[model samples]
Target: MNVISDQRVRRGRKFGQVLDGARKVFMRDGFERASVDDIAREAGVSKATIYAYFPDKQLLFLEVARGECLRQTEEAEAMVTAEVPVRTALTIAAERIVAFQLSDFGQRMFRIVVGEGERFPGLGRQFHDFGPGLIHARLVHHLGSYVAQGALRIDDLDLAADQFAQLCKASIHEKLIFSMTETITPELARRSVHGAVDMFLARYGVGG
Candidate 1:
C-alpha cells in the first residue's frame, strides 16, 4: 500500500482496538466507573493512544453508543424501501428493530445511557439525536415518498414516523430494558410489528 493507505489502515486498526476496549470497560463498570486507564489496559494500548482517538471518556462512550445505533440503523434502513408496500416495508423494519433492541448488546448500551445519562446531560441527547433521530429521518423520507405517490395521507409525516417506531416497541421494549423477562418470543415481536403496521395504516393507509 502507499504511505497514505498504510496510515489509514493503521488508524482503522487503532480505532477498532479502542472501541473494543471501551465497550468492555463501559459495559462492565458503567460510565462513571470506566476510566481511560481501564480502557487502555483492556485494549492493550497506552492512555495517550486512547486520547488520540477520543478526547475523554464521555466522547469514547458516545462513540460506542453511536456505533451500536448506527449498526441497528443500517440494518433497519436496509429493510425499508419504496419498492415494497408501506405495510410490508414497515413490518420488516419493525421486526429488525425489535430484534436489535432485544439483543444483549442493545440492552447493555441502553442501560449504560439510562443509568448515567443524568450525570452527563448532553450524553442522552447526543445518543438520541444520533440514533433514533437518524432512524426517524430515514422513515420520514420513506413515508414522504408514499405520501407523494398518493399511497398514504399524513398531515405530519414526522409524527407518523415516530408513532410507528414506538409502536414497534409496544409491549416488549420496556420489559427488555427493565429485565422483566429473559426472552422476547418471535411471536411477541410479530404481534408488535403487525399491530403497529395495522394502527399506522388505519390512520395513514390510502384506502381507508
Candidate 2:
C-alpha cells in the first residue's frame, strides 16, 4: 500500500537539506575526502536515505551542483520567443545566466569541477552537457526563427548559439570561472550583455 517509494512523499525538504549539507561537506573536505556518512549525519538522515536519492558520494554532490546548473539553464531557456526578438532575448538571458554562473557558490563549484573533474571525468561532462550545451541548443533553435523571418542570414543556428554563449562566457564566466577575477557589478553585467548582443546582431542581422 505504501509503494509510492520512501524517497518521494517528504523528499522535498530532505533532499534539499541533504544537498545543502553535501555542498558544505564537499567544499570543506573535497570530493575524495567527503564521506556519505558525514553528509547523511550532517543532513540528519540515514546513509540509506542518501543512497535512495544519490548513487554515490560524488553523485550526491553532482546532483547539488547540477541542480544549480538546471536553475540557470531554465532561466536561459525562458528568453526564447517569437515576440522578444532574438538579440534582445539573448542579452537578457545571458545576463541572468552569467550572474548565476559567476555567483559565489557557482564559482566554488566551478573550481571544484575544474580541480577534481580531471580524474572523475563524468562529473565534468555532466555539467557541460546539460548546463551549457542544452542552453546553446535552445539559443540556436530560437535564433533560427530570425533567419526564417528574414531578420538574419542563412547559416547554422546551432553555430550562432555557440557564438552567443561564447560571448556571454567572455563577459562573465571566463573571468569568474577561469581567471578568478573580482566580482562584477550589475552595471557591468548590463554593459557586457548589451555589447555582446550588439556584436552578434551585427554579424547576422540582415541589414549589416
Candidate 3:
C-alpha cells in the first residue's frame, strides 16, 4: 500500500506542524519507541488532530522520514551547478555527501530505518528511494553532462556514480555507522571528500 497516498493522509494547515513534531520525536525515540501521545504533544496538536491527518504512527514516521530525505537531496542538488568545472562540481558533491552521512540527523534516520525495516520493509524502501536512490540519479545526470563535455570519460555512468558516492564515505562513514566513533573531525571529512574527488578524476577525467 502507498503509505503516503493522499487518500490515506489528509492535508491541512497543521500538516507541516504535525510532521515537524513527529520528526523530532521519531529522531529522538525511533519508530517503535515513539508514542502517539508524545508526537501529539511535540507537534502541539491533539491526538485527534494528528489522526485526522495521519492514519497511524507508521505512516506518519514514513512521511517525516521521506520528507527529510528529499530535503537533504534537494540541498545537495542545489549545491551542484553546471557552471562550475567538473572537478569543482565533483568536489562539492563529494563534500555534500560526506557531510550528510556524518550528520546527526542522517545517522539517526539510518538507524531508525535499519532497526524497523525487518518488521516494516516499506520503511527501508522508502528511505532508499528518497535518499540514496535519488542521490544516485542526480549523480548520473551530472556525470552524464561531464562525460558529454569530454571532461570525464565514464563508460558506465551508473557504476561510476555509485562508486563516487561510496568513495565519499571511505574513511569516516564506517566508523560512525558502526559506532566506532562518536564524532568526525572536519579534517577527517575533508580528507575523505578530497580523496574521493581525486580518485574519481584520476579514473574518469579526460584521457583517464
Candidate 4:
C-alpha cells in the first residue's frame, strides 16, 4: 500500500508550518495523545488550514516522521564520499548510526512507532523503510563499490551492510532502548563506532 496519499494533501506555503507544528506536538504528546487542535495552535494556523493540507492526524504524523528520517539519511549519505577511504567511510557511517540511535529524536521516534505499531502496522513499516531500510540500502551500495575495487571482499553485500549497522549498536542501543541508561558519553559512543569499524574491516577488508 502507498505510505501516503499525495493527492489528498494540497501543497501550500503553510504546508511546512503544519508539519512543523505537528512534529512538536507529536514529540511532546506522542501519536495517540497529540491532537489536531494542538497542532493547529502550535503551527499558528487555523484548524481548517491543517485539514486542507492533511486529511487526517495519522497521515500528518507519518509525514512528519518520514521527513525527519529523510533529513538524517541525507546528512549521513553526504558525509560518505567516493574519495574517502573505505575504513574512513565505514567509520563515518557507523558513527552516524550510533549517534542517531542515542539521540532524543531517534529514541522518541522508536518508542512512538513500537508503541503504536500493532494498531497501525503501516507506521512501523514506513519507519523501517525510511530509516533502517534506507540505511541498509545505502550501505550495500557503498560496500558494493568498494568490493568492485577489491578493497573489500564481501560475499554478501546485504548481510555485510546489516552486520556493520548492528555492530554500531553493540553496547549503546540496547541500554538506551531498555531505559537502562539515561545518557551515553562521548567515550562510549566512540568505543562503539571504532569497534564496529574494526570488526567489519577485519572480516570484509582485503587479505582478511
Candidate 5:
C-alpha cells in the first residue's frame, strides 16, 4: 500500500487503542462519569489525539460500542458455520451470545445504546445491520439450504430465520439481561440449547 494508506491504517490502529480504553472506562465509570481526559490517559494518548479521533466522550463511547457489536456478530456468524451438528452449532452460538451480552461489557453497551440512542442515531442501526441483521441472514441462508435438501420444513424462510435466531439466543438471554439473573452454568447453557432445539423442532421440523 501507499504511504498515505499506511498512515491512515496506523492512525486507525492508534485510535482503536483509544476506543478500547474508552469502553473499559465507560463500563467501569459509566458514561456520565467518564471524561475524555480519562480515556486519553488510559489509552496513553493526549487529549488532543482523542479529540482528533472522536469529537467528544459520547462519540468515543459509541465508536467502541459499534466495534464491539460488529465484532461479536462476526464471531457469532463464524461459530454458526463450523462443521458440527446443526443442533450443536446453534447451541454454542447461543451460549457465546449470552456470555457476550450478559458480561459487564455487554450490559454497559446495552445501557449506552438504550439511554443515548436518540443522541446517536446510527448506533442502533449499526447493530441492526451487523448484529442481528447479519446473523438472521446467515441463518436463513444455511437453514434454507437444509429446507431445500429436505432436511427441514421452512415455509416462511424469513420468519423462520428470525425465529431460529430468537429461539437459539433469546430464552436464557432475556432472563439474564432483564431479570437480574445470576450466573449461567455450563449445565444451564446446555439445557437451554437442548430445550430450545427440541421446542423449535416440534414447531418447525419436517416430521412434525
Candidate 6:
C-alpha cells in the first residue's frame, strides 16, 4: 500500500511540473509555435515523461485551461449563494469577474483560445464549458434562488445572468482585450461592479 501511494504521489508531482512547463511555453509561444520539445526542456523532464502524462499537446492545453477555469470558479463560488442579498452578491461576483478577466493569465488564455480555437476546436469548447459556461450556470442557480425569495423578478434566469455578466464587463472588457489598457485596480473593479449591480437591480429588482 505504501509503495503504491508513494508512486501515485510521485506521479502527481511530475504531472504538476509538466503542466507548469507547458503553461509557460504556451504563454510565451502561443499554441501553434510551441513544441513538445520545449515543454519537456522547460519542465526539466524527458519528452517521454510529458507524453506519458498527456497524449498530445491539445490535451495538455485543455488541462491548463481547465485549471484556470477551476481556479476562478472555486474563488467565486463563495460569492454567489442564497444567503447574501441579491445586490451585494452580484456586486461581489462582478468585481471578481472583472478582476480575473483583466489579469495577465486570463488575457493570455483568452488570446490563446481566440488565436488557436479555429485550428483546434476543442480548445474553445474546453474553455467555454469549464469557464464561462460554468459561471453562467452557477449564476442562473443563484438568481433563481433570488426569484424564489422575491428579491428580484427575473423571468429568464439565463438571459438575466448573461446580461448581468455583460454589464459587469461592459465598461472595460473590450479595452483589456485589446490591450488598450494594462492596469486594473481594486477601485476600478469596485466602480465597475457597483455600476453593473445598480443597473441590473434597476432592471430586475422586485420593486422595479
lDDT of 6 by residue, 105-145 (tens): 77888898898877876667767776778788878988888
Of 2 and 5, which scores higher on lDDT? 2
Residue pairs that clash (backbone atoms under 3 angstroms), model 2? none
Candidate 6: lDDT of 16? 87
How well does candidate 4 match the true structure in TM-score terms?
A: 0.91
Clashing pairs in 3: none
What is the number of backbone collisions in each predicted candidate, taken in the order shown?
0, 0, 0, 0, 0, 0
RMSD of each: 6.0, 5.6, 2.2, 2.1, 5.8, 6.2
How many clashing pairs does model 4 include?
0
- Residues 163-202 of candidate 4 have per-residue lDDT tens digits of 9999999999889988898789999999999999999999
Residue by residue across 1-208, what tens digits does model 5's lDDT show? 0111111222455777887788788887876678887888888988878777665455565566657767776776676643555666556556655566557787666776666567656666654554456666766787776677565777898997777666656556667667656776777766766776777777767754
Which stretches of candidate 1 lie above 4 Å from their native place? 1-13
Per-candidate TM-scores read 0.87, 0.79, 0.90, 0.91, 0.73, 0.84
In model 1, pairs of residues that clash are none
* C-alpha lDDT of candidate 3 relative to the true structure: 0.85
> Could you tell me the lDDT of residue 7 within candidate 1?
19
Per-residue alpha-carbon lDDT of candidate 1 for residues 1-208, written as tens digits (9 for 90 to 100): 0111111222445898899899998888888899888999999999988777665566677677767778877877776666788778777778777887787777777888888777777777777776677778878998888899898899998899889889888999888867798998888888998898899899899886
Query: How much does candidate 6 score in TM-score?
Result: 0.84
Model 1 residue 77 distance off true place after TM-score fit, in angstroms: 2.3
The reply for model 5, stretches above 4 Å from the true place, is 1-11, 56-59, 79-84, 118-126, 169-171, 178-180
| Deviation from native of the Cα of residue 110 in model 4, angstroms | 0.5
Candidate 2, residue 95: Cα displacement in angstroms equals: 0.6
Candidate 1's TM-score reads 0.87
